[model samples]
Target: MALLDIKGIDVSYGKSLTVKNCSIALDPAKICSVVGESGSGKTTVIRAVLGLLPGGGSVTAGDIVYENRSLLKLSKGEWRSLRGRDISMIFQDSGAMMNQTRLIGKSFVEYIRTHESISKQDAWKKGAEMLGRMRLPDPDRIMNSYPFQLSGGMRQRVGIAMGMTYQPRLLLADEPTSALDVTTQAQIVRQMMELRDEYGTSIIIVTHDIGVAAYMADHVVVMKDGRIEDQGERGYILNDSTNAYTRKLIKAVPSLGGKRYV
Candidate 1:
C-alpha cells in the first residue's frame, strides 16, 4: 500500500483557492519531488499534509490519506500524535525559525523531551548524537551556542539533525537546500538520501531547483498555478516529456560548466 495518498485535494485560504485536484502517491523508502516556482502551491501542499496550514487556509475538498487513514478528517489531538513522531517537516530557512534567545542544546533538548518520554540528559545525548551524525564540527560547542552563533550552513544542518531526530516514517522537506551554497546543498541532499536508506523514510521534497529534483527524486511532479501539470517516473519526466511546460522545466536546470561541441 502507498504510505501517503493525496487524492484530488483542493486547498484554499478563505475564498481564494490554492491547490486544486492534486493527487500523488508515495511509497515507503522512496523520494518524491514536487517542483514549482513560489506560489504554485508546493509548500502549501506539504503544509496541508503536515496539518500546519496558516489561519484561514483549509482543505476545502478531496481527501489526504496517510497510511490508509484520512488525514483531512483527523482531529487536532490525532494530528498532534502523528506530528513529530510518525511524520516531520523541515522548513525553508529552518535556522531563522529557531528561538534566537535559547541555547541550541536547550531548545533541542526541549524538542526531544516533548516528543519522547526521556530524561533531559538522555534527550541531550540523543540530540548531540544526531548533530554529530549531520557532520557538524564540535557538536558539543554548537549545542552550547545560540542559533545566531552558527553559520547559515551549520544552522541548516542543525535543522536537519532535529528533523531527523526521531527518524520519522515520512519526512516533508520544503526547499531544504535552497539557502545553502552548492557544495553544502549537495551534502544536504546526500544526507537526506542516506537518511531514507537508514530509516526507510518516505520523502516529499518541494523545490524549484530542477537539478536537485532530477538528482534526488524517484518520482517527479511539476506544478503550475496550483495544479499538477505533469508527473511521472524520474527518467520519463526528464527525457521523454511531451508537455511544453514540462519541457520548459527540464530545460531550466543549469548545466555544469563543460566544453560543448556541435
Candidate 2:
C-alpha cells in the first residue's frame, strides 16, 4: 500500500472551492512534487494534509489516507498523537515558524519530550545529533542561539532537523527552499534527498520552480487555478506533456547541472 493516498479531495475557503477532485499517492522512500503558479491551491493541499486550514477552509469532499488510515476522519486528539511522530512539515520560512524569545535548543528539547517520554538531557542530545546530521558546525552553539542569531540557511536547516528528528513516515514541505539563496537551496535539497535515502521517508513538496521539482521528484503533479493541470512521472512530465500549462512550466525553469527543461 502507498504511504499516502489523497483521493478525490475538494477544499474550499468560504463557499468558493479550491483543489477540486485532486488525488495523488506517494510510496515509501519517494518524493512527490506539486508544482504550480501562485494561487494555484498548492498551499491548500499542503494545509489540508496537515489538518491546519483555518478561516472556514473545509474539506468539502474526499479523504486523505496515510499509512492506511484516513486523516480527515481523525479526531483532534488523534492528530496531536500522530502529527509530529507520523507526519511533519517544513515551511517556506523556517525562522518565522520559530519562537524568537526562546533558544532553539530549549524548544527542540521540549518538542522531543512532548512526543516521547524521554529525559530532558536525552532530548537535548538528540536535538544536537539531528543538527549535526544536517551538517551544521558546532551544534551546541546553534542550539544555544536564538532564531534571529542564525542565518536564513542555518535557520532552515534547523527546521528540517527538527521536523525529521522523529523520522516521520510522511514529510510535507511547502515551498521549503523558496526563501533561500541559490547555493543554500541546492544544499538543502541535497540534504532532503539524503534524508529520504537514509530514512526512507515519503515526501510531498509544493513548489513553483520546475528545476527543483525535476531534480527532487519522482512523481510530479501540476496545478493551475486550484486544480490539477497535469501529472505523471518526472520523465513523462518533462518529455511527453500533452498539456500547454505543463509545457509552459517546463520551459520556465533554468537548466540544472547538465539537465535542461527542454
Candidate 3:
C-alpha cells in the first residue's frame, strides 16, 4: 500500500464544493508535486492531507489513509499526535507560522521536547545539528537569533530543518521557495532533495513553478479550479502532454540552456 492514499476526496466550503473528487496516492521515499495557479485548490489538497482545513470547511467526502490508518476518522488529539511526529509541513512564509519573540533555538528545542521525551539540552543539540545539515553558517548564531533577525531564505531553512527534525514519514511543502531569490530557491530545493535521500521521507510539494516541480518531483499532479487537470510521471508530463493546460504551463517557463532551440 502507498504511504498516503487519498481516494475520491471532495472538500467543501459551506454548501459549495471547492474540490471535486480529487484523488492521489503518495509512496514512501518519493516526491510528488501539485502544481496550479492560486485559488485552484492545490493548497486545499495539501491542507486536507494535513487536516488543517478551516473550521467551516469540511471534507464533504473522501478517505485519507496514512500508514494504513484512516485519517478522516481520527480525533483532534489523534491528528495532533500525527502532525509533528508522523507528518510535517514547511510553509511559504516561515515567519507567519513562527513565534515572533522567541529565539529559533529556544523554539526548536521546545518543539523537539514536545515530540520526544528529551532533555532541553539534548533538544538544543539536535536543533543545532539540523540547522547545520541545512547548511546554515554559524548554526549556533542562527539558532540563538529570533525569526525576524534572519533573512527570508534563512528563516525558511530553519522551518525546513524543524519540520524534518523528527524524520516524519510524510513532509508537505507549500510554496517553500516563493519568497526566495533564484539562487536561494535552487539551494533550498537541493537541500530538500538531500533530506529525502538521507531519510527516505515521502514528500508533497505544492507550487506554481513547473521548473521546480520538474526538478523535484517524481510524480506531478496538475490542478485547475479544484479539479485535477492531469497526473503522471515527470518524464511523461514534460515530454508528452495531452492536456492543453499542462502544455501551456510547461511552455511558459524560460529554458535554462541559454538559447531556445525549440
Candidate 4:
C-alpha cells in the first residue's frame, strides 16, 4: 500500500482557495518532488499532509491518509505524538527556524524530550550522534554552538539530522537546498538521497528547481496556478511529458558546456 495518499485535496486560506484538486500517492522508500514557480501550491500540498496548515487555512475537499489513517481527522494529542516520531519536516531556511539565543544542543534536546522521556544528558548525546551521522565534523563543538555560528550548509545538515533522528517513515523537505551555494546544494541533495538509502524513508520534496527535482525524485509532480499541471515517473516527466508548462519549465533549466543538466 502507498505510505501516503493525498486524494484530490483542495485547500483554502480563510475564503481564498490556494490549492485545488491535488492528489499524490507515495510509496515506501521512494522520493517524490513537487516542482513549480513560487505560489504554485507545492508547499501547501506537503503542509496539508503534515497537518500543519497555517491558521485560517484548511483542507476543504478530499483527505490525506498516512499509513491508512486519516491525517485530517487527527486530534491535537494524536498529532503531537505522530509529528516528530513518524514524520518530520525540514524547512527552507532551517537556521532561521531555530531560536537565535539557544545553543543547538539545547533546542535539539528539548525537541527530543518533547517526544521521548529521555534524560537531558542522553538527549544531548543522541543529538550529537545524529549530527555526526550527518557528517558534521566535531559534533561536540557544533552542539555547543548557536545556529548563527554554523554555515548555511551546516545548519541545513543539522536540520536534516534532527528530522532523521527517529528515522521517520516520511520526510517532507520544503526547498531544502535553496539557500546554499552550488557545491553545498549538491552535498545536501546527496546527503538526503543517502538518508533514503540508509533508512528506507519515503520523501516528499517541494522545490522550484527542476534540475534538482530531476536529479532526486523517483516521481515528479509539476504544479502551476494552484493545480497539478503534470505528474509521472521521472523518465516520463523528463522525456515523455508533452504538457506545455512542463516543457517550458524543463527548457528553463540552465545548461553548461552545451549539455543541459537535467
Q: Tell me, by TM-score, which candidate is best.
A: 4
What pairs collide in candidate 4? none
Q: Runs in model 2 with CA error above 4 Å?
A: 256-262
Q: Which lDDT values do the candidates have, in the order given?
A: 0.91, 0.92, 0.91, 0.95
lDDT tens per residue, model 2, 1-262? 8988999899998989987989998999999999999999999998999898978999999998988899898998999988888899999988998899999999999899999999999999999998998899999999999999999999999999999988998899999999999999999999999989999998999998888988999999999998988999999999998899898888767664756646
Task: Give the Å error, residue 147, model 4.
Answer: 0.7
- List where candidate 3 sits over 4 angstroms from the true fold: 257-262
Model 1 lDDT, residue 125, Cα: 90
Of candidates 2 and 1, the better by lDDT = 2
**Candidate 1 local distance difference test against the native:** 0.91
Worst 10 residues of 1 by lDDT: 253-262
Report how far off residue 102 is in candidate 1 (Å): 0.3
lDDT of 4 by residue, 11-124 (tens): 999999999999999999999999999999999999988988999999999999999899999999999999988999999989999999999999999999999999999999
Candidate 3 minimal-lDDT segment of 10 residues: 253-262
**Candidate 3 lDDT by residue in tens digits, 1-262:** 6999999899999998999999999999999999999999999999998889987788989798998899989998898789988899999988779899999899999899887898899999999998897788999998889899999988999999899888999999999999899999998999999989999999999999889999999999999999999999999899897899999888888886654766
TM-score of each: 0.96, 0.96, 0.95, 0.97
State which candidate has the highest lDDT: 4
- Looking at model 2, residue 17 earns an lDDT score of 95
How high is the lDDT of residue 200 in model 3? 95
Kindly report which residue stretches of model 4 are placed more than 4 angstroms away from their true locations once superposed: 259-262
Model 1 residue runs over 4 Å out of place are 257-262
Error of 3 at 64 (Å): 0.7
